[model samples]
Target: MNHLDHGTEVNPIKSNTKSIITDHNKDDHNAQEVKAIVRGPIPAAAVPDHMWQAVIANDRAYDGQFFYGVTSTRIFCRPSCKSRPPKKEHVFIFQHAEQALQAEFRPCKRCKPTGVRLPEQEWIDIVKTYIDDHYASPVTLNTLADISHSSPYHLQRTFKRLMGISPNAYVQEVRIQHAKERLRGTKESIADIGAKVGMDNVSYFVTLFKQKTGMTPSAYRENKASNTMNDVCTPD
Candidate 1:
């Protein structure tokens, strides 16, 4: 299978789905729900019966664990899901949204994976969309807060809390990725790519690029170009 088209290693732990949807809230069914899951490093050790009991008592056991953001429906469910379980073999688990997106998983409208709090996810969603659309433009927390209709402090914390990264850092990463994409695919000059990504100084942009990617913009372009030539000459 093509590695680009296949996502095997990231697949979630599978569970036999005797039943899918349950009427009980996950809290009420904690005992069985916890039993259904294996936390920490999988295949290393099975979760003990008492360990599951403890998880039943404390609902936050899966806080840092990888979870699958199923794309067919707008929901991010745990690997050990018993309620309305998706096909055991078809699920993907991610450590966070970054990995989920890397695997082409979209945000779930139902569970709202980004925002774990009530009424907060919607606000964060708007802010994230704004950032994605305008990442190339120079953004300040104040401007973002104004558009988000929230305070700068709130925006900063909420973004960090939900996205697992700061808004500024997210913007920078996006700009860098966008610039790299352009650099690889377009005939744009280095200065133009920098300008497109909202960097005023091309030299500064090169510095940021090197810091993040361990290579200058020109160096990266050359590498991509060489690889392209090699691929073109390789046997079919």
Candidate 2:
């Protein structure tokens, strides 16, 4: 397997603080929604000069959905900040934190543009909100980080450090746990349970259920039924 296949952000160019900036801004998602949803490393793209000026202006009239990647530091932001403007040569507009990281631009400790600095408690709480809202849909840490103006690496690190597991893992655990509950509490088929949990690979779902609970999903259902029956027969 290509070592690069693993989950870290992918940077095509070695870190080039000066040269990463370029002209031309076109992304498919810009027209689709008020907010962007990203799930992987930021793609390399061209950015125009006027866009930077628009950001410094914080022209809410100008769509900010794709403009805040630099809001946490020197690269992005309104032209209106009290501090002096960034050198034209050193500035580049990133659409997301993964883009900045791929370009090797460290977050401004002062601005900390990404929502990554949120306390673990707050981070988990927000993640729960995301899950509640989008659990049935296809979503990933990259998507969640996109909501926070940061990269998957930043969010994953903070989430793991605080929650003791990767965000993706926590999501999977939550999904599987929910699936198990439905399987035991309802007459839903194994396939329905899997689908309800955002899983479609019936075989893989069964395997995961077995791995996590030491029993097939069907067996788990049977166990739950038997327990209910025994409880009903016994007092209270």
What's the lDDT for all of these models?
Answer: 0.64, 0.60
Alpha-carbon RMSD, candidate 1? 21.5
- Ten-residue segment with the worst summed lDDT in candidate 1? 38-47
RMSD vs true structure, all candidates: 21.5, 17.8
- What overall lDDT, based on C-alpha atoms, would model 1 receive against the true structure? 0.64
Question: What TM-score would every model get versus the actual structure?
Answer: 0.50, 0.52
**Candidate 1 lDDT over residue span 27-97, tens digit each:** 44654554355332222134344433322333344544545543333245443333343433344445565
Q: Cα deviation in Å at residue 131, candidate 2?
A: 2.2
Model 1: number of backbone collisions: 3
Clashing pairs in 2: 55-78, 56-77, 56-78, 56-79, 57-79, 70-76, 72-113
